[model samples]
Target chain A: MLDAVIIVLRETLEASLLVSFLFVYSNHFSVNKKWMFLALVSGIAFAVLVALQLSEISDLYDGTGQEVLFITVLLALSLLIQWINFIVIMPNYLKSNQQLLKILFSSIIVLAISLEGAEIIVFFQSSLANDNHFHANLLGSILGLGIGISAGAVSYYLLNQLANTGVIICLFLLVVVSAGMASQAVSYLMQADFIESGYPVWNTNTLIDERSVIGQLLYALIGYEATPSFTQVIVYFSYVLIPSASFIYFKIFSVRKN
Target chain B: MVLSKTGSSVKAKRLFLIHLTMLVIGIFSVDASAKRLTIEIEIKNHFFIPDKIEIPANTKIKLIVHNRDSSSEEFESYELNREKLIMGERKANIFIGPLAAGEYPFFGEFNQKTAQGWIIVK
Candidate 1:
């Protein structure tokens, strides 16, 4: 039962956190609630389709198709965040049409949710089918969902409070999250041998096992890996450092100079 | 200074994007040749049958994972970087590499305590 709870919580929290973050940010721009609703509905529907077609998807690209698709989505999301940053910085960027900007961000949020939600849905469905302890798993599932929603709410509240500090910090966090997603995609590529991973960097399994509760939370928050390969460590650090440095430079030095 | 910094960062991002795109295309093109040397493993009671599988080094091999239990399990390997969720009573296929001799450990993410296994590439 705890296993069921953990699985559902992890999956749901990942997507929910993204949703809450974006939704809270959208409030600052007065994004249309209706558009967000539509995006959420469609994202879930599309996720169902993806889950249903798992067999075919798994069979794609000689058994590495799932990783390919997953990577493509992660990269797309990363690019989308950069575009969002551009939109935010440029005045009259959407031709003074705030609605369009809102719609765009909402759609991307939907896409992120769909990808994460589909996995959770599939896991629950399969677990319910296989296990005899349905009631127990169901209870665990409910608890997981509750915890996930609470976590999202807490994040939304924190971001809302931090809005007084300006959108800079929020944007930084978003950039970090995007980088984490990209690193995860890289891991999949390395797994498929699409990318060369030279060696294991270090084993922190003794100090902090990624399977533990705190480790899982960190994984969802920032993609913590106990034992990462050489390639993964390099990519992860690059993603973290580059965007952050750029953001700080642009916000502080560039703004002051201007 | 800011403009140059942003510009340099954008260039780096673009380079990364191009590398990823090329790799994607390369994978699709090369996948055709990877459909050889099939290996089978079964899971029962959250445990992989014959948990240690030895295969020839430097060969592209197909892995067929059969999940005999009634529940689904995600076959995860940080070492191998391949993760696939195999539904109970169903079989899933995965492709693994032409590689150096090493031990690649894999386990069921859902049943990590019981479902541990390794692929020995020799």
Candidate 2:
């Protein structure tokens, strides 16, 4: 139940952030109200279509196909997220008090619908798979989404007050969280066999079983595996390390040069 | 520097038309190519089949997932923003992007041991 809530919250929060960004952008740009409404409707419709399609497609395959499908979706999502980070989020983070409202509106329709929509659909499927009640999952998802959106909006407003100091901190935190999420996603795919050669690097399950509460929390936050395979360990370390190293390099060298 | 005002206005009009045409074409192509790619996924006795996949760039895929086991499973990928719930002996479909070349991974939220897969776009 708790896990379900977290899943829902995370998914919904992303969607809410997109929507909030759109709202602010539209208002700042003074875009025609009709066009803004059209964009919102389009985004919602697109999300529904994607969600329906996912459920329908999941019905088609039996074993290997299913695994492949899951991996494919995860990879696609990860890429999309990276794109957003590079294109939208990062730009906003780097600038100081420069309202990116115009840029935000440019791709708001597509980005808002696709990313958030997909997240919600995935959360529902995962919760249901975990033996959760349908009603409970639905409720949790809606609640989480609400909270997430509220948090994002509030945070955005707060950052405006604290200026660059708050913005930089939040941006850094977001990067770390996103990296963690990316690693976990990759690990899950490796375990699924949709990817090849993911052997355990070492079997630490004997030392600390992942079934415990602490183990589960570690798994949730840091992509911890008690008996991590060779591929899993390599992927996790590379995912975190490569990005962190790049970030450090950019901070120490690139920024200083500028 | 020597151009007449009428000639310059005509040139401007032509440029605007070209820009408009390009925008229209871009929108049309994106819409036309949004077709979903279908992939078949399996679950048996509570395990995922194949467990990993590599997708090339610019392919939109639809996953057809079937659950043969008595228990339900969820195929989830945060990166792809995709998830599908399969009840025991039931099937479902999840449509994912015209993904660029990269890696996106997923798994079964419930039967973690059995359901796992990856989208590798090259």
Compute the DockQ of candidate 1: 0.23
Q: Give the poorly placed runs of model 1, Cα more than 4 Å off.
A: A89-97, B1-38, B54-62, B69-71, B78-81, B88-90, B95-105, B119-122
After superposing candidate 2 on the true structure, give the runs of residues whose Cα lies further than 4 Å from its correct spot: A1-7, A14-43, A59-139, A197-258, B1-84, B87-122
Question: What TM-score fits each model?
Answer: 0.79, 0.48
TM-score, first chain, each model: 0.88, 0.56
What is the C-alpha lDDT profile of model 2 across A1-258, one tens digit per residue? 444566666555554554444444334334444554566677667766666565455434443344455455445444443343343233335344233333434345554555466556655665565453667777767776677767668855765455555544444443444444455455545433334323334656566656565654444334456644455456556555655565576667656777
- lDDT tens digits, residues A1-258, model 1? 887789789988887887776777687766676787788888889888877776677667876767777888888876676667656645446357577667667777777877887777777776677566577778888899899989988988888877745366556666667767877887778655576544457867677777788878887877777767676777778776766665566668657877
Tens-place lDDT per residue, model 1, B1-122, is: 45688899999999999999999999888766555688999999889998999999877777889989887788988556577777667777776766569898999877667889999998
Model 2 CA lDDT for position A254: 55
With a 3 Å backbone cut-off (N, CA, C), the pairs that clash in candidate 1 are B59-B98
Residue B55, model 1, lDDT = 92
